[model samples]
Target: MGLFSRKKEIMVGNICPKCNMEFSEPQRTLRHIEKAHKSKKKFECNSCG
Candidate 1:
């Protein structure tokens, strides 16, 4: 049997633009960008903390 038996999973987060992984939080998103995507772009959200 295949490991994935259902539709693709949906994740929530700011798109890193580099790696394209969904992040649940801002900090994690930033980390992913920095560590994985190697993104220097800054992300500032007014409604998010």
Candidate 2:
């Protein structure tokens, strides 16, 4: 292994483009999405806009 190298993923939670909500784990957020919210819209970065 070296610097600036790709690593294995842990299947973390999905990123909300609309809001800056980040989840360290997916299970918690997945449940929240399934229960609290139904469908979510994708958002893009304003800076990248």
TM-score leader:
1
CA lDDT, candidate 2, residue 23: 62
Candidate 1 achieves a global lDDT of: 0.65
For candidate 1, list the clashing residue pairs, or say none. none
Question: Compared with the true structure, what per-residue lDDT tens digits does model 2 show for residues 1-49?
Answer: 4888885554545654335467666776555555556576477688986
Candidate 1 local lDDT, 1-49, one digit each (tens):
9786996544536766565777778668776755765436477778983
TM-score, candidate 1, is 0.40
lDDT for residue 15 in candidate 2, whole number 0-100? 57
Please give each candidate's TM-score: 0.40, 0.32
Q: Candidate 1 — which residues are off by over 4 angstroms?
A: 1-13, 39-49
What total of clashing residue pairs does each candidate reach? 0, 0
